[model samples]
Each structure stands twice: as structure tokens, then as C-alpha cells.
Target: MATLSASPNPNPNPNPNFRSPTDQTDHDPESLPQMELHPSSDQDPTPNSNRNFHAVLPTPPEATAPAAAAAPSLLHISFNQDHGCFAAGIDHGFRIYNCDPFREIFRRDFDRGGGIGVVEMLFRCNILALVGGGPDPQYPPNKVMIWDDHQSRCIGELSFRSEVRSVRLRRDRIVVVLEQKIFVYNFADLKLLHQIETIANPKGLCAVSQGAGSLVLVCPGLQKGQVRVEHYASKRTKFIMAHDSRIVCFALSQDGQLLATASSKGTLVRIFNTVDGSLLQEVRRGADRAEIYSLAFSSNAQWLAVSSDKGTVHVFSLKINGGSPGIDRSQSASDPVTSPHSSLSFIKGVLPKYFSSEWSVAQFRLVEGSQYIVAFGHQKNTVVILGIDGSFYRCQFDPVNGGEMTQLEYHNFLKPEAAF
Candidate 1:
């Protein structure tokens, strides 16, 4: 609600270059806010910085507010299961925001070490799992500090022999991903429930369905580009050869009924039926190579949102039928890819690989490589995006037109003058 800087914006992209939209027309890029953040000394070990703006949050002795061009880059960003709120890992510490109005609800500066490299919020918001990273190194890489916001303290933690890459939280399970293994624990007691051997997952890639109906966990398999899906209730595991190249990203629907995976190629995203591992639908982000950042399935399971290094977010409408079986692998292979131009895709099989991928149903393109994360909103046709530069955007899409999404509101999380 306040401007962090008194001076003019130090950096602004005069013109942002973007590729052709996958479905709709390209529109204006949302403007970003500039802010500075510096953590001060804290006497209380675990200060609730949200309400107590003056609360002490001890930082390294030689730290100052980030300059306009030197704002901390986001290490990780995650949306809660309900999509009502989002959390981000920043240099100073971590902050949680209410998605609807796009305002900061909680701002906790890393008291001792440095910025939290990885941060994930559980269910409603009482608990948080955080790890060390960013320009400042706070906690050990091998442990996840479970912070209890209510008590304003780290009440518990999960320790591992190796660095923790990422964490996924649910009502009953805390899934922790390491370089080559996944640990699933009982949330209540933190007891080791099951351990999974995985390939070299440097990114700590893992996802768990948050539905109360059934529990499903996913992580990298032993083989490259393979995904291991574990049905906790049934106690069954299935491996799907998800990609030709190494898997880049994967997301499961709330109910675990669908799975979407992308490869290093980044051009195509494949959706599968979790039950039978059948290919459901395939969508295209573009015809070029890019790093996939995050993928999310809407709460209702009707839309899929994808963010990547290209500084663009694409939302694709899914066609899931309850009665009909998923697309047959053989028939799906021959299905004509939806090309941008009919002439270019007339012979999809013979056309270049670029043309043989299904384009996104709707797209929102920004300056290339903003490093963003996307989530479907609770209200229909809405999406939320948080950028690496600390920019937040809430937009609405028109499913019928298959066009660009419109920005509803935006905020700069770093804009508070009190951040210093």
C-alpha cells in the first residue's frame, strides 16, 4: 500500500519482446513495482513480523536495503491448495500474500542466517517448511524447519542426509525431495512412512495430491524422464515413461486423476490419466526450448496453468470426460496437432516438430524470462502470477474466445517503505 522508493524507477523495460500467442491476441505487459528490503536485528528468536512491524529480525551485520536494481530474486514460490494465498522465498526472508486482493498477510524476515531458499505452506497456514538459500545462507541445507506461525517458533523439523530440494505438504503427509530420494512422513508424528529411491533430481521435483478423497504422491523415477506415482491408500505404485528427454516439470490434479508433465524440450506438455497412465491430452507452450518453472491444475480440474523461463504463462482448458476412456496411445499419436495455421499443419506428421504440438487454449505473455509462477484462482476464469522480480498479477481469462487474459489487479510486494 506504500511506495518503498522515493526516487524514480531505476530500471524499466521500454519494450518487451514476445512470441506469437498460442491462442489469443497479445496485450500490454503489466508494469512492475520497485521496493527495497533489509532485515534488522531481532531479540525474540521467532518474532511474528506480520503485525509487529518493529519486531526484531536479526540479519547479517553488513546488510542494507536492496537497491532498486538489486532487489533479491525469488528462490521459490508456492500457492496453497485452496489457491486463496501464496508464499514466496525472498532474500530477506519469506512473505505470504492473500491472492484475491493481492496484499501481504505475513512477512517474516530470516532472523539468523539468510533468505530461505525453499518455503512451502501447509493446508490453512499454521505450519511452514523452510530451507536455506538465496544470497544469505540461513538454515542448513539438509534440514527443513517446520515453523509454527501461531506460536511464532519453529516447533519441529525433518532432517535428511542430503540437501533438501523441495517440499510438498498435505493434511497427513509431508513429502520431502532430495537429490536422489523422496521421504514421505506422517505429518502428525513426523514418523518415516515410506522412502522412495529416485534418479538424480537436482531440482527436488515432487508433487502430492491434496484432496481428502485419496492420497497420491509423485516424484522422479529411477529412469530418466520417468515418473513414479504412489497411491497411498491402495499401496500401489506405477511408473509412466513421461518424456523422451529428462523431465522438467510435472503437476497432478487435486484428486490425482490427471497428471501433466513436460520435458527439457519444453515444446509439448502431455496430460495423462493417473489411474491407467493413459495419455489424455497434449498441449504446446511454444516451438522453442525453455525452462519450465511451474505447472498447476485448477481446483475444479478444468484448467491447467504453466509458467516457464520464457516470461509467459499459458492456461489451457482441459476436456475431461467422466465416462469415455482416455485417448488411446496409438490413436493419440496420430491425432493431428493443432497448428497455428492450417496450411503449416496440413501434414502434421511430416511437418516440423514445432507444428506437431497442440497450442495453448489461452495465453498471457510477458517480457521473456521474468521467472514466474502461476495458479488458478478460486473464482472461475481467474489466474494469479508471482514474478521473480516481486511483481504480482491477478488476471481473468475468457475461455470462449481463446485469447489473452486481462489483468484485473496488480501489486508490488516489495513496495512497502517499512521493508527496511
Candidate 2:
């Protein structure tokens, strides 16, 4: 899933501790033609705001109380396209960290105490899409500032009439999502390529394929329970009525060939073939409804992982292939696909749907009610989870056994002292 930003709104008030900020280098005006769409500022405009440009490290446990008084507020968090790295936007600045051997690669603090609400990274490149947020924004909430870390400046920007809900990036394109519209631009020169209209998307729900040579974009459609798939390569648009309720969250495979969606009902997650919009598989998250926070496909698309308010991360095996009729029903004790099913499944049609629904093969439990996003790790059979409560977990699942996953690592990225 892309990084979600708060709805565009004016800053409440300026932080009194902020100090004057140093000016950033101006972009070459002769570089690109001025057009209707413009970007925002990276240089802090508040002359009295404090600026603390430094590499941030975890405060010692003994200093936790004091640090809490001045700790930077987390504004946003997201994984890169490949999930090899992740970024966190804070009120003071943003920090990027490696995923596998988790470590903060670098951090940029605007001592002026400006907040970054959204940070979209293109793989691990220096280029990033940033939007201002929090009580004291670093930039206007209506603009998407393209930041170039190598130069330590904003190289370009995309301005809109309203606040930007989120931004998606690819090697060749930049996608900006508003409440009801989406704009696609050519990355090389920031030329507007296409525009799309969507339903009231306050969460800025959008997903794009990261596979090279293919452009697949998915967003909410005009009607409830609808999803729009844009296949730029084939010049085709496919709309799928994914559910009867409102779409809460969805994810596309790396190749954009498969899509998984959960609705406000949230008990069921359906996977579809992007090419034909055909139902390929359906998995149950629970008998009762729950908010599905995130869904992800393994690099090979053989497994699907889901996280929800239930404080559980469930991994389900994907057995259906594109263009195939349905899931392969042949099963045995030795079968590799180990997703659990109720023993009452024998009378599926006679019993409630819950009795026959397929359940996760493996699960990891956490504190209930906190938001967490999950993604399959680069390491095989591993899943990486990031939580709003500052928890980071990496667990390995036994594909053949199907049960509780083994916790391999844990860290409180937000409160490192807690990890100690």
C-alpha cells in the first residue's frame, strides 16, 4: 500500500520553539517550462523556527522521560516499492531505514520543526515525494515536493487545488492522489500524462505495480464497492465490483497481475486476475467484521498476508493461477498448501459460509487496536510488520505446517529504549 496522509488542512499553530531556517538553493527557472501545476517549498518559511539537522539515534532508556518531552511526532510511514527499505515522516523531518538488517540509513531534520506528512520513495533512490503536514508544516499541504537527497533540495513539485492525500512513484511516472482525483505525470520532465476521477477517497487508497515495463494503477471507482484498474501499457481500464460494502483496503501484486481487496465488511478478502477481473481466490479473515489495515503478496505471489485491528497478521497460501477456473481442490495431509479449514466443511452448502471458509495458514498476534502494516520479507517465508505503536516484527512461517509463526526479531523502532 502507498503512504497515506491526513486530509489537507491548515496548520493549527506554529511551534514556539522553532527558530529561523537557512534558505535552500533555488531551482533553475530555465530548466522546465512553467505550467498550471506547480510544487511546494522545502526551505522553511518560518524565520523563528528551530532547525536541528542531525542524525537521530535512540535515546537511552534512562533518558526516556526527558526525551519524551521533546521527541519528534511521527506523521507518516511507508515501505519502498521493493520493500527493502522503509521511510518515516516526523514533525521534525523524515528518516529512511533498511528493512532486512533494520537500521536507519539516514535522516533529514529541518531544525525549523516542520512536519512531513507523506513520504513516497522510488525504490532506494535519492528522489522522494514529500508533503507538508502536522501543526507546523514544512511545505504547503496542497503541494507535492520532489526532494533530491543527493543535492539536499527540492528539485520539483506538483501543486493541486486541494490537499494531496498520497503520492505514488515509479521509475517513469509520478502519481498524485487527491480526495476525488488522481494525476499521473512523466517522471523525466513532470509532464501531465493522464488524469482520473475517483470516489471520495479520504484515505488516499491507491496501488501501483512496480514491475518495469508495465504500468498498472488501481484506485477507488465512482460507486461504492467498486475498484478501477488502469492498464497503461494496453490502454485498457478494468473496473471490478469487488464487494458489496465500501472498499477499506486493497493491494496489487508486484507484477500487477493479481489484486486482493477487503471491504468494510472485512470478513472476506478476494483476489482477482487483473487481466480479466475474474475472481481467482477468496479467503476469510474471521467470522466477525474487522478493519483490514494492510494486504500484501509475496514476491512470487504464492502467499498473501493480511493485518487487521484484531491484532493478528495472517498469511494465506495462494493456489489459484490467472485464467484458471478456481482454486485447486485436491488436498491431502501431505499437500503443501496448509491453510486451515473447518471440519464442518464437509457440509459447506448446508452450513453457514463461515464453516467452509478458508483460514490463514499462519498467524502472529500483537496488541489489539493499534494499526500495523505488513509485507512479505525479501527473505523467503518471512514477514515484516510495522506498527503505529512503534513496534517492528519479523517472523518466519512454516509453509508446510501452518500454525503460529516463529518470531525471529522485534524492535520498537519508534521507542528504541523499549526494545532494550
Candidate 3:
């Protein structure tokens, strides 16, 4: 396999003492904490006096050429075991490539259909779910199709109540969250297993397998600032609340332990404990408002990659301390001694920043057992491989240092010869 690797930085802490003393307090800042201030008398006198701030600005030629040369424009990108593929969904259907060689395996066309909107892989069965629907009249609903990769045949059609926004494949079930409700169907027979109603239109849906017979739904509702989690089998609501100015996106760890949420308002990303619905860490980046559209965790549950509206992918490492920080429920009780209440404490860790870049991340996945390869889908259908610095990765599960993703492998899966 063709691999792109970077030496892991031994010390991930670019700013160890970066936290302000005020951050330890419970209150969030109303405005940006003053970094530096100048009196009116010191204000710039001329129109060009603020040139200090523009000193490093890139020239137009440099700006235009850099972005154009970074990577090829893509239609869609996905990651498999050792390969990553990019498809030009509109013109030619799909292409398959080896991640390491970056070599074209095949090029297939599904030109009869207009294009593909979403492409997802069934982790358990190794099937591909291609959803096609857009503003174009030629490509309306009923275009959703599932293909068997090994056999290379379109074996099934997925029916949805409304346009399909997201599709998640669990061990034995496929959950499709549409405009109104979430439908869970058996992957084997495509039989409806359960349906979940939503308070607001769902913008995103993520299913985390709980290993036994349970699955957790982390959904971002269309209404401003709404997010919820529901236990599918028990039909029990787990957690629901407004976390951001506009809840644009949310994601759950594969193990169903951690939940990462982001908003369209700015650079704030919050992590919560899935077991008790308690806030664990809050991360803020950049000074201006930014919209986060996608979030993903590596399969091993150690790193989180967040993509914003500005086309930037910010990656962070998950760190867990040995002991859980105790929560004081006494503040909420009318009678602390007599109230039927109990407090819970669990492990706590700092969610320090690991890596950041201007490349927009649409989707990301980690290769199982391969700590080096972390694949991500980018804007304009491109994919970029990143090298995770060693210092920034720490496993939250049993061993705490196994989450370092240091390499990337890209494959082109869509081929013209394959059935579209």
C-alpha cells in the first residue's frame, strides 16, 4: 500500500500553559478575554497604519496557486481497510485506487443516474450504500442503491420516507435518518426493525453500537440548538438539550462512550460523557465564528477530527485520567440529606488540541489495527492524509497511548468499468 507518513511530534503540547486561570471557573466568557489593549491615543493614525496586521498576508498569485495545487478536485471519497477512493460522481461514476500506490485500479461510470449524494460502507458486510438525490430533476428519489463490492452488483434499493440525509450501518441493522424520522432495518433482509420520531427535522444521525443488543442515536435536529440521544432497543430517551447556537453537527464514538458536538456559531466543540450526560471538556479555536459541519472519531476511540464551514479539519486527542471527577448534585437538591439522589464520578481528562489545518474535512475513518492511517474526505470531493504527531495521541480506553494516527492511504474505488 502507498503510505504517506510524518514523524510524530514527541511533545504534543504546543502551549502547555495556554489555559487561562478563568477557564477553571464555571462561567463562560461573555466576550473575548482581552489579550492586549491600546488607548485611543495609541490608535493608528493613517489608513495604512494597521499594516502590521497585514504584513503576512499572501499575495493574490500565491493564494490562488497554493489552493489550486494542493489536491485534485473530487466527487466523493471513502476509506476501506488499506485503500481510499475518490469518485467523480457527476461525470464518471466511480474509481478505485490503492491508498499506498495512489494507482488507479478501475474507473466505472454510472452515467444513467445524475450523480451520487452520499456514499457509505457497511463495515460488517463490506457493502456500499450509494444514495443519489439532489436538486436536479433527472435524479429524484428512489435512486438510492446498495452494491455488493466483492460481487460488484447492485443488490438492493433503499426506500426512504423523505430525502435521506444520513445512513449508518450497525452490526446487523442499517439506520437511515431522513427528514422526519429514523428508520432502523435489518441489514440481512432490509426489514424495518424500529422507527424513531424526531422533535425537529434531523440534520444528522449517528449510531454507536453498544455491543450487546443496544445502540445509541446521536442526532442533531434542524431546529436551532437542538441535539438528542435515544436508545433504540429500549425506546428510552437518553439525553436531549441545546448545546450550541445552532446544532449543525454531532458524532458519537464507535464504542458509545463519548459524544462530540459542534455548532455553526463558532469554534467551540464540546465533549460529553455518554454514560451520564455530563459535560467533560469544551474546546474553542479561532477568534471569529465558524460553522462545523462534520465530526468523526477514529475507530480505536482516541482521536476526534472536526470539520468546519471554512473547510478546516481540527484534530484532537482524547486523554483520560485515572480517576473520575466527582459531580456535586447537592446544589440542585432542595434538601440535600433527604433528597433521593446520588452523585457519580468517573475518569476525567483534558481534551487538548492536537492538530489543525485549513483543509475541509467532510468525513473521516481510522483503519482498524493500523494506528498510522487516518483517512478524511475533504471539500470539492478531495481527500487528504494527515500524520498524527505522537505526542498528541493517547488512548482513552485501557492503554492510553495507542491512538496515534501517523499515516494516510488513498484509494480510488469508483471505476468506469464497474456497474453504476
Q: Highest TM-score, which number? A: 2
> What is the TM-score (0 to 1) of candidate 3?
0.55
lDDT of 3 by residue, 1-420 (tens): 000111111222122212231343422332212111111231221221221111111222223333223232233444432123422233224434433335444333442333455555533132556665434312234334554433333445554446776666654566777766776655555556666666455453554553333677776544566666776566666664547476666766655667777766756677787666777665553446765555666554444566554434445544433112332222223211111111221212232232221212122334322223233333212234422111011111112222223334332232223222
- lDDT of candidate 1 over 1-420, digit per residue (tens): 000101122232111111111212321212111111111122112222222121224332224343223445577787876778888887657777778866666666654436678888764445677787766656666777766554445545555678889988875677888898887766655556788999999988888887656788888899988999998789889899999899989998887878999999987888988777888888888778988988998776667899998888988767666612332212144322232333466678886766655667678877786688788887778888888777888888876666788988877776645242
lDDT of 2: 0.77
Candidate 2, which segments miss by more than 4 Å at Cα?
Answer: 1-69, 322-335, 416-420
- For every model shown, what is its TM-score relative to the native structure? 0.77, 0.82, 0.55
Tell me the spans in candidate 3 whose CA falls farther than 4 Å from its real position: 1-75, 78-91, 96-107, 111-114, 124-126, 134-139, 199-207, 210-213, 221-223, 233-235, 322-420
Arrange candidates by lDDT, descending: 2, 1, 3
TM-score of 2: 0.82
lDDT of 3: 0.43
Separately for all candidates shown, the number of backbone clashes (residues 3 or more apart, or on different chains) is 7, 12, 27
Scored by lDDT, model 1 comes in at 0.68
Candidate 3, poorest ten consecutive residues by summed lDDT: 1-10
Whole-model Cα lDDT of every candidate shown, in order: 0.68, 0.77, 0.43
In model 1, what are the clashing residue pairs, if there are any? 24-403, 42-56, 42-58, 113-138, 114-138, 310-369, 311-369
How many Å off is the CA of 89 in candidate 1? Answer: 2.0
